[model samples]
Target: MFKVGYFYTDCLVPMVGNNPYATTEDSAAELSINAEVYSLPSRKLVVLQLRSIFIKYKSKPFCEKLLSWVKSSNCARVIVLSSSHSYHCNDLQLCSCPFRYLLTPSMPKNVQNKIKSLNWKEMEKSQCIPGIEDSEFCVRIPGGGITKVLYKESSSREIPMMVLLKFVSEGDNIPDALSLVEYLNEWLQIIKPSVNDSTLSALPWKIPSSWKLLFGSGLPPALF
Candidate 1:
């Protein structure tokens, strides 16, 4: 049996004035017109994919203690999905089955740097290109998010992963390699099996189908 736990993360994208994108019964009228809009107000959207999975269980007392901390914390709910019951990136990427997990979560350095800056206006307007839009700065607020993720190391084997995530708004920070691990731990605690368990049984970890949504056209990196 397999299970998936999930949470809702919110984001705001300011539309300058009112939500020009807001649609009324009338299609002919678009209240928003072509204009220079920067430092837009925060707009809200419910991102459906801010999630992680807990698919393996190694009965370590220390892990148990951590699990206790998560349940007590109001931060958010964490869930994990893995093939071998471990979230090890190596295992995930080594899986014989072709997968896209690594492709999605791997945030490029260029993008990550942009996310850290608190001020958007300070950003050079010219450098912001189409792939990287202008007038948008993303920052991720910890403790405020509703979901967490952690990827455990595989015992020996490797697995492939494909991931898909949607940012309801681009105003928040992008998940980094390190940050992704923190959330993964949160999920591990929630779904980790009880003690007295020796080996990792069947777990909930797996590369998901969301990648299809993101790289609908772009090809994934080939695993050698």
Candidate 2:
């Protein structure tokens, strides 16, 4: 399962746009969920999506409820995809990699080992305040909305969760989405890698029709 933020209406929504296997109708839940589930006799993968509306105000309850539902559903792992302000990248963070991950204390040992084998950098931890033992070493995402909250709450509950995020500035985030998906593929293999046949048809993933409007027809030929 994955939860993506739409801070600028560009976080990860487009990735789920085109051909969702399932979608939620208007509902009364704190958030709406649309899912694409791929199931075999032995394995399953579900991609979940929730719009970022009202998350700032209701993140705690929302995440708790969602995690509870996931627990009930017998899901084993959760991966959240999101972005943070590139400017917030510290000297060390920037020097390391464009992407980082956060792992809950309860994360499976195998997963942690895989991350280590890949040599991916985990988000550096910092004290919430200048100096306070109570603050402790914690991963901080300066402009990453709801990411910290979700990680904290999930960790407290001992849910197996991981977050993969990129450092980016707001703009044409379509490229960011592509980069993120590729990064995830490096870990999850969502799309099969290849040296030939660059078409997305090689995978079940579909591009949403909404992407066509990504860059509009260009200022009515006047602002140019």
**What value of lDDT does candidate 2 attain over all alpha carbons?**
0.70
lDDT of 1: 0.28
**Ten residues in sequence with the least summed lDDT for candidate 2:** 5-14
Pairs with steric clashes in candidate 2: 18-208
What lDDT does the true structure give each of the candidates? 0.28, 0.70
Q: Model 2, 81-132: lDDT tens per residue?
A: 9888998766887777799899999999999999999998888887877358
Top-lDDT structure, candidate number: 2
Off by over 4 Å in 2: 1-43, 130-137, 195-205, 222-224
Query: What are the runs in model 1 whose C-alpha is more than 4 Å off?
Result: 1-188, 194-197, 201-203, 206-208, 217-224
What does candidate 2 score on TM?
0.72
